[model samples]
Target: MEKDAGMVLHTLFEQTARRVPTLPALQWKADSLTYEELDRVADAVSGWLSRKGVGRGSFVGVLQERGLEMVVAILGSLKAGAAYLPLLPSWPTEQRLEILDEAGCCCLILQSAFRCESASFTGAKLELDDCRALARVEPPPAERAEVLPMDLAYLIYTSGSTGKPKGVMMHHGGTAANISRNAHLSCEEGTRCSFSNSYTFDVHVADIFKPLSVGGVVIVTRDIFRIPPVDTLSTLPSRVTRARVPRALKRIIFTGEPPTQASIVRIPSTTRVLNIFGATEFFDATLKIIDVHGCPSKLQSIGKPLGDYVPLWVMDPDSKELLQSGAVGELVVGGLQVSRGYIKRPELTSYKFFQAPWLASEKQEGGRVYRTGDLVRLCQDEEYEYLGRVEQQLKLNGHRIDCATVENKLTSIEGVSEAVVVLRDGDLERGQLVLVAYVSPSSAAVSVSSFRDGLPAHMVPTRVVGIDTWPRTSSGK
Candidate 1:
């Protein structure tokens, strides 16, 4: 198989670094690193790793909190021709060990003072505090090792439906394609992004590398993504947020879940709110910008496919037949962004990634496709409306019910703040799945009986459990 003529990630970083040596590449609270300075530092990092026996195809584990040090570790690891496995300091020791063992990590990167509690891994350790010593060692050149575009750029582990975290391997080409597709992100043009999302999350993959790809700058704040939406907006500088005033931020890129009405109102109406939908297997499947600025896609829609790089297909889950517009089916994504596959899981990778049958009939092209397992429909305008997960569809009261419909209906009500519908043990005699809801302010003027005015009686929640907040993970599960 011939490799595509794609540029490696670190190679792209070098192009921008040379093009804009004086441009601010990264800015934290008080310190900012220019492109030249960052390149020098990354080179030093590469040399440090090289001396520690980290080379091409090596998986180096990174367990530092979000900071300038973490950035150095990532770029440096890539420059050294090794894939960086990012781990949060907050993750459980057991989980960290599992990832370490599963990926067969060759080394670990962390701050000098940082240490994982109850965690032990037999790998060479590199610390950020060694920058001074590394700088004195006459560091090796950035081009010393060859890391091809098809080589693994990073491995982001995400918890699957089975409640186990698995690493998703992303090659340089897929990541580079995403950055190139979103090249307009350059902070040089005054359009910048706040980098607060956890390094462990794939969303951070773009926030960290996209700017460097375009000689743009990214504001790095510690654990900014973990905080609430309101606080995250405050970290952006005036220059970045000046375009979209009254919101205190430039472009707010949100993923994982839809933003709540309460959160939306806080953002300035003019601020570009981009809703990104993606999985570990694919960097970005759809890019939907929600605003009244002549944007055609609805707020509920996931917008059109990202670019020519990634094509969309709504396929019948059972027959694998392609569906027409407005027909609900599984969302299949195929293109350069479709990943190589899951690491060390051939069965899962084969099941998830495959050549789509629709390619022969609809596209007239040949390529592997990742079955998203997300139920959606293509609108008349070619936009796709998200209908929740395929597993989200459950059987209740002998009706193939979609809980998303019920939850969406409830949230659509005027007074309700948020709503989550869960399945409980159904009635023994009726043999129907019971729907339980957990929402705040149960008496928020929502009539349980009147709520059923539009929804089927069976779709209504069998029980309403009031709560101040829903129990969720750090990712807002």
Candidate 2:
């Protein structure tokens, strides 16, 4: 839409604000803000951040719960030409501090309600209340930086194999391309989309900006299950249930994990279920609109690439050679949706984000493509059937958990020499999967509760078992 080749995300929001200044932009509980109101407040935030020396190339840490304030902080950071890094309050204090330090954040926008000791951060700190107060007073005119499309827009930290979270550096151009494609394909004017995902999750970018970019409203709430009917709803497949499905829901997006045939049949035929397959490295790359009446085989496919902006290919995991149709191989994603690579991780970035020699003659964006570790097979009609990952990563409750990260944390515990983590069926009767950690030396007294402090709830193992010996195949001497 509108030649998004070099567009910036916030610029689209500003354009929509000017078009429909009185339209509702965001609503949370009893609080709400019109386009004009939200735009003006975001300008004030940008002014405040600008005064604090936060401009292009700067990183702003956002520490707030999901609500109106979080959206303001995000918009304000973008308007100030600085990338916003989401610092979840639920994370351990040390984890949050580590992320902020890694990103070299120049400013932190923290909500007064969220308590954490940020004395370690040698940067400007502005409370959300102060941001609100600034909106009440006329902000001084400050020269706005010329934020370019290639400028960094945000930093999202995903679980890493090195026992630390890695920040994904996303730029304005790629993010804008993703939001524009999704909005043009699914959203409409004045569409009301539910903001259900956490800000730390990359999908939240689509949930919030997708609607705002199209003069639509973002229904910001702590619980989407309790919200009124909205034009679009995005959530995990496990969260979908007959009782929780909103009435009059038009479209529901399922991602994070594959949806079962049983889960698809529960939705009303009138509603469209879009099973999106994507990663933090890139946004929504492929989308499959489930046909409730179709066969079970069709439901298993993660439909074709979203548009020309994101091109998909299947390649040999070892040789990195492109594979033909019907051959199962790693999924390679190329085009504008590809992120700017991981922050401060050039080795990993170069390995994962590389230019395909075959595509050198083609018109590819930046001549870069991301090697998604995910394995897949190209099916008929240009659809793809997911065949799991080549690495030991698991998706639980809509969040990707690196098994190596969990194992690393387990080994860090006292008395534990080595650790291995695996996803197993915890409840066979309910067909539920759970993470279980196995440590060497059966005598190692490791408590599962200890992991709760360091890892996210989803990444923590449900049980820890000590094993005296490692299991191996019969061929192993």
Candidate 3:
């Protein structure tokens, strides 16, 4: 792999600026920012941030929906030599504040209308719209800004112990590496798109960054695209082709609540669907591109690693050893794709990232491999079939959830002492969960109805069953 990290990103942006400056880079409800417009806005924001004493090594928190503002904020952060932290609007203000504190964010950017709403960041907050309001102002001072390839580019806040949040620090080198390897996968020039996805989800990063990096235009819409539209279930294919999704534009990407058959049938014959599998720690690990006729287009398998930067492994889960050819095990990954560590959290990082002895035999040392927590069976053909996660984590309607996270909430119920939750397969259009709980007699007086009232709709198990005692392992004390 090349040592220079920012080369790919700088090159992509420069190419797009030169070729498609007037093409729509971002399109919202009524407002659209062409490549030239977006570039100017990003530069303006960069200049404004520089005047505010923000530059290389600075962390800037961005709180905005997926729209023109989000695009500008991300590119601006890159230009300003700082990492941009994206926070979801649905996130609780208290949780957002805690993340800001952990990241040591000096300046927070938000929409002007959002300022009227409640937020709890102790850092200096700047209105994104207001920055545009001051567009007429010129940059104050120009200073030399130097950014190391390994300098932190962004810090994403993920779930943590103590029910708080932990920040995952990403470096420019790693970010640029992933973008470089995947930009070619996006739609080419003149492609129109309905940019539908929550900005917080890591998968959306590919959707936003890659398209923009290329000369294609991304139509930014307020209405979330992942949610299935019942009205267009029968006609989605034609609409999709007109929308010009990425090369792999299968209707299945729009995972809805139950996964309706109508929605599945809507996949046009011309649409190409790509099944993506990976975690935040590992971006775009594997790709299985399916044809509109629903056949594997690439290698009849998830293709090989993207760049010279990644190494893959299949290990025996119970033995915690490398599985020979045709043996099934948990998939482990190591290489440039592996991030340095979580921000200010060494314990968690050590727990997930560990020494891979298999690398020793391969003559590759001095690297840590991430245990993906995935179970895969190596086929005789040398390809791997994904079995599923070894834990309670599952993708329901395209949302990641750990049964433990919800089970913990159930046990917190006044009457419940212990709880177990499982996903039930059915109604591919809507997802449902079953919750089994054990409660004390006195606590039993607290009705299941009342207990459910205290939980979020998603956490409230569809079926609630009361148990007399909780199951325990043989080694239980």
In TM-score terms, which candidate is top?
Answer: 1
lDDT of 2 by residue, 255-327 (tens): 7766655456667888888998887898888889888778755655888887776778899988989999999
Of the two candidates 1 and 2, the one with more favorable lDDT, higher being better, is 2
lDDT of 3 by residue, 408-450 (tens): 4554444444455666644556654344433322234444576
Candidate lDDT values, in order: 0.72, 0.80, 0.59
Q: What's the count of clashing pairs in each model shown? A: 0, 0, 9
Name model 3 segments beyond 4 Å from true: 3-11, 116-120, 130-132, 138-141, 160-164, 224-264, 291-303, 361-366, 393-477
Best-performing candidate as measured by lDDT: 2
Please give the lDDT score at residue 69 for candidate 2: 82
Whole-model lDDT, model 2: 0.80
Report the C-alpha lDDT of model 1 over 259-334, residue by residue, as the tens digit.
4443454566656677778877887778777673442225568888777667788889888888888899999988
What lDDT is reached at residue 423 by model 1?
Answer: 84
Candidate 2 vs 3: which has more lDDT: 2
Write down the TM-score for model 3.
0.71
Ten residues in sequence with the least summed lDDT for candidate 2: 468-477
